[model samples]
Target: MKAQGIEVLLVFDPANMNYLTGYDGWSFYVPQLIVVALAEPEPLWIGRGIDLNGARETTYVEDANLYAYSDRYVHHDHRHPMDFVAHILRERELDNARIGLDMDSYYFSARGYEVLRRQMPHASFIDVTRLVSGLRSIKSPQELEYMRQAGQIMQRVMKVALGNVEPGIRQCDAVGEIYRAQMRGTQAYGGDYPAIAPMLPTGRGTSTPHLTWTDKPFVREEACILELAAARYHYHCPMARTVFMGDPPKRLVDAAMIVADGVQAALDAVKPGATCEAIEAAWRSVTAPRGIVKESRIGYSMGLNYPPDWGEHTMSLRPGDRSVLEPGMTFHLIPGIWMDDWGVEISESFVVTADGYELLAPFPRKLFVKP
Candidate 1:
């Protein structure tokens, strides 16, 4: 904030709110803010009166720094929680200070921004998008440990998904088994809810990513894509694999080999001095010759997050992203191809080591052909 000349930062992203103050709750349905100021030693947590105690229990913030608005402000037409936030800013003499807002964050709703902007017209608001998230890109020792545990859970989760997806099985039933594996986890520690639900795109649905399940049963000779994650303490480790119910077509077999090779080439290109785009170039070199031209990025930085997404939104493996690679940075290298009526996906979540990279999930990086 000192470098950006932002005197006050209104942190609305729940992951960021957790990163700064260790405040975690499902109260983000309404308005909430972590009022961070240069003058104050402790950041203030402002939210609904009902969640005040939750913040006190989950966060290290002092009682004096925790403020809550009455029930009237929640979903009320006459008032908003930002009004209460503005009053607090006035009390701290920060009403006129330069403020920073995460404009692109999913949690920072437009109505909330409009209310805060209208309430504090004197303050200069800067769009500091990805500022806090960038800080969270590199994993700390403890954060890496949590992610490793999440990866261990992911190994079991993926095995369950691969085993459950077979001929004559309902897509919903397969996902049910997956959910049980995700929640029951290993005998050691249980799993937390992933930011994204299990993406079980089957047959034609496989041509497009991000589709959930249906009651339809799997047919022989059709393909299914299993994209799922396992989380531990809010830290997520996601993985994807393709499954074939019967004899695989030669076209898909060749494509799967190309994807596997491209993924490995990208991983082999990782080093301390390499850029994000260079890693993408390595994958492109392998795919361009095979007539695969993917417009979407192959990989992205990911870690601690909430519902809707698990990516860090900081950096990505694509053309022109010149972000330098550094040790301790984790990424999901999901290089997939979706054609007109068929698709194949194979991915790996790995962390950058000092010399190279290490795969998080100890699973096979190949398409599973269930005969």
Candidate 2:
């Protein structure tokens, strides 16, 4: 925040709220707010009375302010949630201060922005989404532990999924089986999004990277690509593997091998001084000449959330993105080879280290063939 000249960073989006407060509640539907006053002693959390206790217990924030709204009654017309936010800022004498707002982080309704603008007309609202994103790119020890647990859960789920792969099984059936296996007998299993349905794309459907599960039955010699996420500790790690039903075609096997090699190349390129674009380029070098056009980034930062604060949504395998690789940075290195008939996707979760990178998920990169 100091690097960006942001003295105060206020977050209201559910993901950012969770990142700041560590309070993962359904108050996302309500007016749950988190204010990080860097200059102050500690952060302030505001939420409904129902979520107060949970916020106090779960969140790292020590000082919490609770608000109770009437169920069947009408209160002061000026007691709306946005009004409360504005009141808090005013009470802190931050009306004219340069306040940073995460434009991409929070999904404020037009009414909410209008209320804020009207209330603090003198305050300078600057977009510090990138600043917050940069901060989130580097994971803390606790965040890394959560992500490691997420990777472990993904490995378990992948094992269950690969074991169930067989000829004549419907794609949806396999998906349902994986979800059941991952979600059973665990409380913190499916983090924020409880159910992450696996994508079992058979044959030509594997050509498309993000193929939806279909009713098509697995056929002999057809490639079955499974993509799934295991949600644990509110963090998710996406794992994908391509397998064949019968004796695999040599071309498919070779292509899958190339994709796996590309992932290794990308991981090998990860170090403290490497740029994001360069790391992606290294992965492409391993597969591009082998008739594979790299469609997307090789990887991106991961954290206590899936599609976390720092994601590959905007910054991608393009020029001018020189995000320096740093220790504690986690990324999903998904390198694939898209062929005319079939495709191969080998993805793994990795954490950047001082010298190199460490694979978080311990799943096999080899293509699994089920008889």
Candidate 3:
């Protein structure tokens, strides 16, 4: 803030709030935020009165710094939570301060911004959407450990998903098992709810990504894609794989091999000084020779996030990114090929090491073919 000349910072992203104050709750559905003033000793937590206890329990914030509005402000046509927020700013003598706002966060609604802008017309708001997220690009030792644990849980989750998906099994039922394994986790520890739901795109649905499952039964010779993740204390490790119910087509097997090899080459290129685009270029070097033309990015920075996305919204492993890889940076390299009628996704999560890279999700890199 001192460098950016921001006297105040309004944090609206739930993940950012969690990262800052350890304030974890389901209160992000309504309006809630953390106010950081340069002159203040500690950040202030503001939200609904109903969630006040939740903030007190989860956050290390002092009771005096915790502020809450009445229930009447929730969902009311005329009464908005930002009005209360603006009032707090006035009380702090920061109504005219230069504030930084996370304008692009999923939780920062237009209505909330409009209300704040109108209520505090004297204050100048700057867009610092990527400021906090950029700081999260590198992981600490504890953060890396949590993500490693999440990867272990993710391996089990993928195993359950692969085992349940076979000829004649309902897609929805298979997804149910996947969800069970994701939450049940390993006996040593438990799993937290991931940011995204279990995506079980089966058969023709595999042609596109992000499709949820239905009650339809799996058929022979069709491909099924499982894109899932497991979280430990909100740290995530996402993995993806393709499954063939019966005798796999030659094209599918060959494509899977290409993807696996390409991902390996990409991981091999990861190091402290390498650029993000270098990894994508390594994968493209292998795939392009095999007539594979993928326009989408191969991977992205990911960790410590909430619903709607687990991606860090920072560096991306694709052409023109040019962001230099660091030792503690982590990424999910999911190179999925979507054809007109079928698709295959083979992915891996890894952390950049001083020498190279270490795979987080320790799973087989081949397509599973069930006879």
* Global local distance difference test of model 1: 0.92
Candidate 1 residue-wise lDDT, 39-142, digit = tens: 99989999999999999899999999999999999888868888888889989999899999999988777877788889888999999999999999999999
Measured by TM-score, how close is model 3 to the native structure?
0.98
lDDT of 2 at 252: 80
Each candidate structure's TM-score, on Cα atoms with residue i matched to residue i, is 0.98, 0.83, 0.98
Residue pairs that clash (backbone atoms under 3 angstroms), model 1: none
Per-candidate local distance difference test: 0.92, 0.70, 0.92
Error of 3 at 44 (Å): 0.4
Which residues of candidate 2, in runs, are more than 4 Å off?
62-64, 67-80, 184-197, 211-221, 247-251, 306-319, 337-342
Rank the candidate models, highest lDDT first.
3, 1, 2
lDDT of 2 by residue, 185-230 (tens): 1454443343235666678878777666776666787878887776
For every candidate, C-alpha RMSD to the true structure in Å: 1.0, 3.9, 0.9
